[model samples]
Target: MNLIKYTSIAAIFVSTSLIIAKILTYHFSHSIAILSSLVDSSLDLLTSLINCVAIFYAAKPKDEDHKFGHSAIEDIASFIQAMIIFISGILIIYQASMNIVNHKVITFEKVSMYTMLLSLFMTICLVLLQKYTISKTKSLVISADCLHYKTDVLMNIGIIASLFILKFTHFYAIDSIVAICIAVYIIYSAFELGKSAFNNLMGREISRQEQDEIIAIIQAENRIKGFHDFKTRRSGQMSFIQIHIEMKGDLTLFTAHEICEEIEQKITEKIPNCEIIIHKDPC
Candidate 1:
């Protein structure tokens, strides 16, 4: 269904619309909190597009120029998304600083307040859908995009709270404070995305649980004396596993080939979309 692709397109529309709404709301209310939310969402359009394009490219089949398929592009897209988010956070902080230093007093009318509430409702729905997409696709770019939207849900909540507080208590500084806090949070999310992308690009090891499961599958096969030199690496949704198994020296060539084939099938049956290579050493 190209769930991620479709979802990213949906996200872009939502983000673009909400960002425009927030901009207009901020224009009228001059609420720094709302502006901060706008800044966070401004990156949404770009990030969602990156996810859409990256997933499409990553899913491309192996070709002459790229034998390993195009999966690595997912991490690259995530890295770019992180940088955009970080820049957005910084800009939010700068705006908040200006408001705080200038002692800008902001007032939110019922309309501005309701606008934020509506934005919050829409973000919640998007986040729920994103969760479902991540569950089905298990895609890195989709997962990363989903994670940030979850944060956006929180950022919207903060913006709404600041509006209500300003609408009632008339404490002007609270809006700026809330905006700054949201900005700091956005930066933290950027760091998380950047770190995850970095790890994946660096060929991080797959989870120990998965490695153990692979070992178990190999060990369970009959005539498999033992295995050693097991190694694993991950790129996006793909896993690469390599190992050396020692077998009886007296075994016939046909028997050894049959054993190897059995082990390969067992591993594939247990783990889908994984590449495994096994080297046999006669002991």
Candidate 2:
């Protein structure tokens, strides 16, 4: 959790620096490609700030009013991030189209390229840290932020490529074309992120593979006759499972409970950060 918080802070700092650098780059170059990168960095700052707040809120303990915990805050944060990214993409598309019509000529191509290189280096470093944090924490919020940075790395590369083409070809329209392409990719990314958030908000079930694994674990218990009413859902880092197992009618209640405990332990070993409720039924 501390690592997640630190990574989120690092993202904010990196985005802030990128926005400052890109602002200068765009001012000097007047390139729509640079402008697109600038817009993305600006939004990255806002998204990182939002992620920080959402993660802090989501870390709160479950209360009487919110028994499920505040994990849904992470989903809400992702939804808002999607909306923000979508709007930025549209705005960039409009700006790029206008540049195309006006026949905008980009200057300071070398400066913009250098700035993009810097941005790329910083973004890659942040993404590496985020990857490590996600591996340790399995945080959805951090994963979403990492996705944004990954896209920024690609955007930086695209901007550099556009600047290179313009430097040699003297074809000004390429800047606007690259910007538009970047905008389209940004919108596509927003859609993918939004869909995942929406599904999680709707209490989507665990994956089929995980469900099969759980089923197999249950079936391995010879004392249990059968099981039914198996249901699962995920919230933040937690998986909630509810299932009823059938057992021999002659078994004592204590024995039945012990069997259930054994099964629960096995499942827990298989899947960490999961809460299980196993109700025993007499066959």
Candidate 3:
């Protein structure tokens, strides 16, 4: 929990700082590309705040209302984050279109490029930190926020390139063109992100490899005659598995219980942080 909180706090600081910096540069540059990237950074701050709240909810224990667990909060939060990104993308495209149609002259100094470079460096650092947190927590919110920031990295690169070209060619349209392209891509990615979170909320099955591994583990036990009715579902970072195990009719209830426990232990060893329910049937 501390790790999740700390990671989110770090992200908030980085994104907030970049948003302020980008605003200053956009004021001086009036570069649509810089403004587009600034819009993304602003959403980044909102997403981080959402992630922190989601992580807090996900940490809650199972209660009467939430008998399974509180893991799905992360997925809900991710869906909302995607919607936020989608809105920002649409707004950027509108702003860029207006600027292009108006034939506005975009004049930006080297400071705009320098500002983007600084944002790029900080984003890279924050992504590295997020990678470490994902390795530790396997959090859906963190992963989704990471995806958003990665696009920010690319947006920064495009903005910097556009500024370089505007400096030389004096082409007022270059900034708007780049911003429009970035915004369209952002909208496309937002749809994909939302789809993934929606699937999790709808109780998507675990991966094929994981199912095979579980079957293999059950088959490895000779005393376990057979198995059937296996099921798997994922919520946030947690997996829930259910299976019915077959045993010889002659085996005592105690022995069958022992076998089921052993098999469950093996499965737990293979898949960490999962819930398992096993039913024994005499064959």
Count residue pairs with overlapping backbones in model 3: 0
Which of 2 and 3 is ahead in TM-score?
2
Residue runs of model 1 more than 4 Å from their true location after superposition: 250-272
Error of model 3, residue 105, in angstroms: 1.7
Better lDDT candidate (1, 2): 2
What's the C-alpha lDDT at position 132 in model 2?
97
By TM-score, the better pick of 1 and 3 is 3
For all predicted structures, in order, the TM-scores are 0.89, 0.93, 0.91
Query: Model 2 reaches what TM-score against the true structure?
Result: 0.93
Give the Å shift of residue 53 in candidate 3. Answer: 0.3
Highest-TM-score candidate: 2
Q: Write the per-residue lDDT of candidate 2 for residues 1-283, one digit (tens) a residue.
A: 8999999999999999989998887777777888888888888898899889988998899899998788888778878889989989999999999988877776646788889999999999999999999889777678778877898788788878888888788888988999999999989988998888888889999888889889999899999999999999887667889999999899999999999898889888777778899998999
Query: In terms of TM-score, how similar is model 3 to the real structure?
Result: 0.91
Give the Å shift of residue 57 in candidate 2: 0.9
What ranking of all candidate models by TM-score puts the best one first? 2, 3, 1
Question: Which ranges of candidate 2 are over 4 A from the true structure?
Answer: none
Instruction: Compute the lDDT of residue 173 as modeled in candidate 2.
Output: 90
Task: Give one clash count per candidate, in the order shown.
Answer: 0, 0, 0
